[model samples]
Target chain A: MRYMEDTLLHHLHTNDTEALKTFLFTIEELPLLQVFTSLSANEKAIVFRLLPKDKALALFEALQPTAQHHLLRSFTDEGATEFFNDMAPDVRVRLLDELPASVTKKLLQSLTASERDATNLLLGYERETAGRLMTPEFITLKKEMTVEDALAKVRLQAREKETIYTLYVTDQRKKLHGVLSLKELLIAEGSQLIADIMSHEVIYVATDTDQEEAARLLNEIDVIALPVVDRESLIVGIVTADEGRHILEDEAIEDMF
Target chain B: MRYMEDTLLHHLHTNDTEALKTFLFTIEELPLLQVFTSLSANEKAIVFRLLPKDKALALFEALQPTAQHHLLRSFTDEGATEFFNDMAPDVRVRLLDELPASVTKKLLQSLTASERDATNLLLGYERETAGRLMTPEFITLKKEMTVEDALAKVRLQAREKETIYTLYVTDQRKKLHGVLSLKELLIAEGSQLIADIMSHEVIYVATDTDQEEAARLLNEIDVIALPVVDRESLIVGIVTADEGRHILEDEAIEDMF
Candidate 1:
């Protein structure tokens, strides 16, 4: 990591774009997909032209909606279709929200049935609200699970989760019981029960809460992320700091002009 | 320099106010008086609170007139008196321009006879023009000097000047004839005269030109700085890229809101 950082700094100092591209290509084996997701629209377009089609589409799905439109306009019909098809349901909904109704209709016609339904469900909420940003990509732990068993379950399910920084603890009825940070789990003795370590005074926002308000609360408290819960207080999804920063930057830009 | 930068970075990151004050106290050997003069009003206030009373007053006098007022409000009568005594004539004029008449009169009374005369001369010019921002700190060279001789003279006089990036090449009458970058001097053979290497096509802004327009002109061209000339096309002062960037940031902030 230090060597890669040093190499990137050297290239930046010399303004060597070719060297930078070579370095980026070599580091594609790492979890660079997350870093690629954080780039601005113009920056993504520049990188997209340098990477493989599949990698480009994967990165595109991770981009903010504004960036998706920009990348789509820069590509041919076949390329655009490949990217649109590979995008996640929640991400697709965000893109559709920004597009004209006629364009949205045409794009919706291209999606599979399940993708269309998932996107439709997400699109029902107003933009810049918790419901619109939340993804149904999280793990729910049953209260009956022992500390050892819960840890094993988390390790098995971690790959598919958005973040494991904060684990949402719920009851058998699917109602959120408490929340626990990953730090507490690592330090706790294996014999200790999960319910003993978890804090029942859970801090979370409702599905309809304003996204800016959610972001502000997270920033004020210096938390890694916040969980979004439904009307019945069941965990829906989490809004991580990376996504919150993107939303904040967008808000700052909007306020600037 | 690297050590100082590291120490400053450490204090900034840790928000260690006491360490910052101690670090500034230890740097008394360096000629910070000139550096303080270049900083904006807001920057001065941030740094001044950490310094001793004597050093603070000396630093305040080095600042521009606009900065002086801002700093004055943060000091006592004794501190203000010491600062006013040390302030340059032209800077005093600039300070009085923005201040209310009642306050300006009180400040003027505090200045010595010679300083008051110099202040009056600078105050005669219109605001937001080259006449307002320019310091009378410049050196004019005869167009006939050998490259070696010119370099030696610059080395001797550069300490008091704002910038030695671009030296104005003038005829015997002190009329601006051409301009030359410091790069030309270092690379030129000893035999060449200043006239031979200097570019006759000098781009300069008039004393009355808008400050923002002057900054834009400097940014558009690949020049280290632009020379500000009076109505008769006599070079007065140079506006460097450092100052240009500061002006651009201010404009960007104003446009932001």
Candidate 2:
């Protein structure tokens, strides 16, 4: 891997796109991110430019928040918009929070309306609150459904969901009633009611709850996802295991800096 | 919350078990764990002794590993046994790793034969590797079964599983062939074969892969559990998102001290 890292640098130095592509294809995302970040700023840009769109997005997400901030400054406005548009909402806000106000304003305006609303809703919360980190893209279920019906709902909507693993059971008022993992749904008899299998003890965090506290609870309980609710206990968004991980990774990086 | 914290502490000082229980019932696990941990050693013992068995076990698991270490030494043998006997396998190893050799040896003998074997497998691995943290408790499947048959298998076998959310499809030789999330299983038509719905792309790690790396992959992909394989490519164990959280928590606590 070290040999490949060096070779990647050598390829970048010589402008050998074919050699770099061969090397990158031979490695995994973790190693690719490592090699890309280990390069000098100019080399990093060159390598990043050469990456395919999906790989580029993955690499961008994998970069340290500081590294991401640096790249934001270096990219053309169109390039920045492309990256920002695909990035996770929390990630986009975190990067924006670190840049100069003038720069952030210009970048922020380029976001599409729905993305802007989602990002702004999170940003409106306190810096380290659950609202700031929770993704608004979760799917919800209704209690009036059978296991088969819920399954159909999840299938139709699951593609766009941040997580369909833990489906929230909510009322017409959007108030949470119970929580159910897809495991329970899968194992249940098809005609069985979701309410019969769903657990009523839904562990949730308020929108204003501290992010670390929420993440810690999420971890301790070993749930793949936790619901974030408003003060009235209506489901608003969901904080996922990945976001909890990103918090830890960002903290570790912060410690080193 | 501050008032409740103060009131609980005061009640503990006054030996007010009734008031304390009332206060505890009104609050959630996160705050209860925090308030309990903040108490004096004498008070902690008093409160712990007063706690119901389930709550005590929860508190024991919620503690920082070092605090768990101190409690092991501080408690009477009977008290310590109750705590140790049911602690999660990976957590047991972590706590035992921090104790004196003689203490660990004595405690090691108390575990059931199967638990001892599982812990020893993890102990045999290098620190920070997947083998050290991977749990031996997991459910595997075969691809030839119908969804209904698989669901029945899951229902019968699910209780002992560390996770049934991400089911592995293995061949006759116990070689993993594909992966299927419970979501996919739930949404599929009941008569369909498991092979038809299961994904061929399985993201996994060898037993010796870095725990953090495997964990990062699991988190990035937002899977409930990650399978750990041996050199022979047979599934050995699974590492869970909760365990990932535990690893990060341990790291954060280590940095603090």
Candidate 3:
């Protein structure tokens, strides 16, 4: 306990706005988040002001729409711009979906051209569809690649990808063919082609599939991730295990009440 | 993913028994547990054989009385002894609560003295109360320690305890006083005393409180854990966030169907 406390004190003393921002952005601690939510508006604003711009934006995106509106009203124009611009397109769409049309219009106008297009595409989808939850970040793999080459490709693009754990295999036209895990590549003989080991017995849901269905499929299969495809069977994104677990947890809570 | 397939194959080959045991024990994934009341004798026996001895016992204990009787008749003497010996006292009590006195007497004869005593104690309580779920695994802390010292106590005892995230504070009389999080201790100054950092505004459910009430209290606070106490405010056990989340998810699934 003493060691844990000392380490914590050291981090606290050395912590800057960047570290604090990162912590706030990826805050998985529900109890702390609840406590923060229950704080006075002024207190929340003070905490918000202390966070880095990007962190503030991410944290704002994660907040409930009602809380977002309350916090937005407190922010200056510059803060609001930073918050809206830094948020992911899908999250922004959800926030817009909840706001009055007038407010959403004003908020949409604040986004960059690319962001606006992304937000609009997501907003066009029905609520609770795969399209609404899907992120645009994914790496597509060519089926001809050797296991070593595929691993190299993953390593190069891994930083920007949502998950490198499961890689989707595609053909010349980028139509989904199979899925592979990084673990298989590292242990297999490097000479072995990805085509030899790729799981052709692939399971996926269409982009228009209901999120609940996607969650159920993931749970039933016990896979870490599931690919999301289009009508043409082209892999677009992956719905991660963590996201599926969160959906399950939320659904469970709803049932209990 | 080729990599995931290889890793899964490797795991499956190396740990077949453990894997089979895990599959059999997870009631959350299996529909058979819910349909036990309708299963034929041969069908029940098939499912029972797939389970490890301990889990078979747990599943047997969890069954409705009529189902238990039908299933028990199918088991050989060795299998019945293994099942009876491994069953938890609280579960055994629930089984006994619904069975006829003659049958209950035969079952009680199979239990060890300690198991029988525990069964009797739990049977005296109302169903679904804190006393039923309380497993006597909680670690209590004296309120006089510094935050650093208190955290050390948690680390030393964490492995044996059910949850280390929320530490229950107690007085000289061993009555519950407050609760503290490891997160709080990490951020607080080392010189700070336990009372200064501890959250005295703790919310708890009494021994007689319903499971739904306990679940609601956990949800309302957004904490991953809650302490259960008796009427005199003595800490009995802690209900973890994961368990609460599971309860909520199960309830949601029930509503969905």
Candidate 4:
């Protein structure tokens, strides 16, 4: 293992992209984290660039906030903006919270207009609130959409959405209306109207609700994502079960201490 | 509230099934638990009988083990047998563990042949093992099946299964082959073969693995269920995420004491 690490480091220093790619080809998540962290920020950037986009995103997501900050600094401005923009809005907010004010401002300015707006919306919320903990990248179905139309919409945008498991149904004003699981849509007849089958009893939290409370609700309800609404019952964002688990884990650690 | 409770109890004592049915018509899971627990075991059984089948199942599932046992004792043998048979194998095992040995034997004997076999398979495993924690009620796809055929099979059996979110692929000998999520199946063309889309690299636990370890793996993978395999790699059962979360919460509480 020591000799393998030395050779990998040598390859990194020498820019042996071929050898580094070969080594990284089958590297699992845990070792990838170790290798990424052990390298200097520049070296980490070099190695990260060699990774395929999906793997790079996965590695970036697996990283600690400090490591993520260092990796971001190592990237070119264009690269930084693109990579940061690709991350879920909630993740971007968490990272922004850890950075110095000037760096955070620069990064925020670098985001795409839509990404910047989403981040800004989250940033406006108080810390530890549902607004700060939700991802704005969610798919919303119009109540009038046919099942086929909804499925098509989900398929077209599924790659970029935070979760396609639970789709929220919104009205003309984007007011929270109803919710249905993707499975519900999949099993329904194509011609069926979404409004006819979608559940109107949506369990949701206001944007200002405590994040821990939101997470507990997620657990109790056993839903893939909990919709976070604004004051007017407009669906603003969603807190996923995975994010809820993290908050619960963090609270557990805090309790331990 | 006291007056309402008194009226409800009067209805229960008078065996006013019509009034009890009306009362339970829109009762939610939490309040049902409260009402079920507050009643005498015999009264609980009467109220339970008045509930719709789905609601009764849900209420029984939501009850604490002690409450479940008390309610079970109040049930007539035929009703107990029918109800016991309807539960997923894993849940039956958990409840059996809490009962007196004679009661456990009676319940086991009351199960249908298939349900009894499934429950016995789970009961055979040591406590806190993956085998003991998994439900045998999972849908398995054949590698050669067309996606359409698989979907049909899932739809037909979906009601009886513990979860339809994650489906395991198994070979002729019932050896676990690959796995895929329902979303994957729904997105793919009907003509596509399961072999082409199912992920060959399945993350699973051996039958003897610790339940906590299995639950942690389920959390890490963020999958709906984790397959548990026996010595010959035969897929025995699966642990759903909801069960995993319960195990995790129980462990957290255990730590606090």
Best candidate according to lDDT: 4
User: What tens-digit string does per-residue lDDT give for candidate 3 at A138-173?
Assistant: 566777788668756765676555566577888865
Report the candidate with higher lDDT, 3 versus 4. Answer: 4
lDDT of 4 by residue, B80-185 (tens): 3444455565654443322222233334434554554444432345568886676667788999999889988886776666678899999875688999987788
> Could you give candidate 4's per-residue lDDT for residues A100-193 as a string of tens digits?
2223333443455455444443234556888777776678899899988997888677766658889999976568899998778766887999
Name the TM-score of candidate 4.
0.54
Question: lDDT tens string, model 1, B1-257?
Answer: 55665665476446554576677676763455544554444344344544644565455556678666755443333433334344465644433223222232333444443453444332333556655555444456677898878866665666656556578887653468998765466457667898898989999887668888888887778565787765456565567755665687699899979
Off by over 4 Å in 1: A1-257, B1-123
Against the native complex, each candidate's DockQ, computed on alpha carbons, is: 0.01, 0.15, 0.01, 0.12
Q: Give the total clashing residue pairs for model 3.
A: 12
Question: Fraction of the real A/B interface contacts present in each candidate?
Answer: 0.00, 0.24, 0.00, 0.10
Docking class of 3: incorrect
The worst-scoring run of ten residues by lDDT in candidate 1 chain A lies at A96-105
Q: Chain B TM-score, candidate 4?
A: 0.55
lDDT of 2 at A94: 40
Stretch of 10 with least lDDT, candidate 3 chain A: A96-105
Choose the strongest candidate by DockQ: 2
* Deviation in Å, model 4, residue A211 alpha carbon: 1.7
Q: List the residue pairs that clash in candidate 2.
A: none
